[model samples]
Target: MSDAMTLREITDFAENLARKAGELVRREREDNTLRTDYKHQTELVTHADVMADEFITGAIRKRFPAHRILSEETMPDLSQAEELDTPLWIIDPIDGTVNYAYGHPQVAVSIAYAEKGQVQAGVVHAPFSDETYRATKGEGATLNDKPIQHSGATEPRQSLFATGFPYTKDKLEPLINRLNAMIHQCRDLRRIGSAALDICWVACGRLDI
Candidate 1:
């Protein structure tokens, strides 16, 4: 809990917490009875999301009791948003709630810490594959405790780009326009349905450009 904890210590702690959350998600991945509901007409959530968020928040509060936690399902007040100026945790316990609801193995537990507008650390865990990606400000990134690198290849032919499916709405036409552009520029684009997984794949060189 000490602010004096080294980066290595923070990474180790975050790694452990990420794995714990992943384990929870993996269990949910196999459960076909997860009750789901729509957060909006497009966005969704499941029992898994609730449980995972609770687990991640508990871990953060236990260690850095004074640190701020910003979760997707529950957010702090905008008036008190400055509390994030200190050690803060941004947690998306289940990044692909829609995928998880449909029994797709494309969800993840993501926790990133920021201090003073800079990302201090990030840990993303995919329980289905036991693939865990960790990154620190300058210490580089890793997967399953091994060093990982980005796919450096930028050629569209050899590169595989990933993105989200376009959301439908009367007022969000601009996002559809931008997404359509990317879909055309890449030889192939996949919607993994999980942002954490998408970024982790980019970090581990599994996907590129």
Candidate 2:
């Protein structure tokens, strides 16, 4: 098969995996089956995270045994990521663990495929809102399969911005300063807990920055 066809196949696989993982997380939350815990005494984690990660990584390994996985839950070792000579799958089973645990609707399942350090395909699925954002290299991006574009607001004062903060609070002065500056420069600011959804919103013109 041609390289382009292979890339398309990988993209489709990633999209399907993301959707399945999304459903798993949403169901877990709806059923009140989440076992919430803290990671490093700061970041939130849940049983759903591990379940989704296992489901995604296992499917990828079975379909593409040669691929390397760098998932947030099970396989987070990135020491050899730069020198790897194979396709890599990077996954975040639950992008907004805190939001997921608290019943917020901004959580997501993030999946990306990269070769030689360049991402070839990516999907961000927000089950709560039933929105799927996907993009393949050189093929543009879409939300729910419809083409999407940025808001194209050149003026900062007229643009709306979305951002997220780290779970740790040791060094938040810089982040606070940046937020202060943005609040003055931008029309408004939204602190969306999910980074994946924040970027998707920017891409889909829901947020300008």
Candidate 3:
């Protein structure tokens, strides 16, 4: 690995693992009986989430064992600088677990890589839509490899910044109030229960500003 941080390597790694995760989702979605439980409050946990996280994280470990994995379902300790010497992968398996739990097609897998504490790359895969979005720092962004642009409102008042109901009490009420303000400011508001997909849509300008 060179200082350049090859875009191809990161892109391919994320895309491949994302596709694998998607397949797992598809399998369970088709089966229609994937076991699920609550992780916290109303947040969900499923075997699919477990399987998908394992699949994606396992692939990363196999390809780059030295890299640290920080995911929604699993935690890996990397308190030392040397531990994060190479890369850090942040992942959310089955990002829209609530949707997936009910056979909704809005679920997705999100993978982001931080190189030295900065988001060097991001990949969002919506298997149900067959749409994939990827972004690399200083290299531009793309949807399904075609160039994509951001259409988010330059002004916070006019912007439709999406958020989720916080799983923790510390931010729950604040998040709701923030969302209410955004709804009033924006042309309209929408909540999809998936933060990754919301961020991706914001990146592509599909949602209102």
Winning model by TM-score: 2
Steric clashes per prediction: 0, 0, 0
TM-score of each: 0.86, 0.94, 0.86
Give the C-alpha lDDT of model 1: 0.79
The sequence of per-residue lDDT tens digits that candidate 3 reaches over residues 82-164 is 44667788899889888888888888999988866667788889988888888877888888999977784677666655656
Model 2 stretches with alpha carbons more than 4 Å out? 1-5, 76-82
Q: Which ten residues in a row have the lowest lDDT in candidate 1?
A: 77-86
lDDT of 1 at 112: 81
Candidate 1 at 34: error in angstroms? 1.0
RMSD of each: 2.6, 1.9, 2.8
Rank by TM-score (best first): 2, 1, 3
- Model 1 bad stretches (over 4 Å): 77-85, 166-168, 171-176
Q: Compared with the true structure, what per-residue lDDT tens digits does model 1 show for residues 1-209?
A: 24799777887788888889888877766765577776766777777788888988887898888887889756866455444556777889888877777778887888887775566888888887778889887899988879999889877777788876544566567767876887777777777999889888987887895
Model 2 agreement with the true structure over 92-204: per-residue lDDT tens digits: 99998888999999999999998777788999999999999999888999999999999999999999998888778889999999898889998999989989988999998
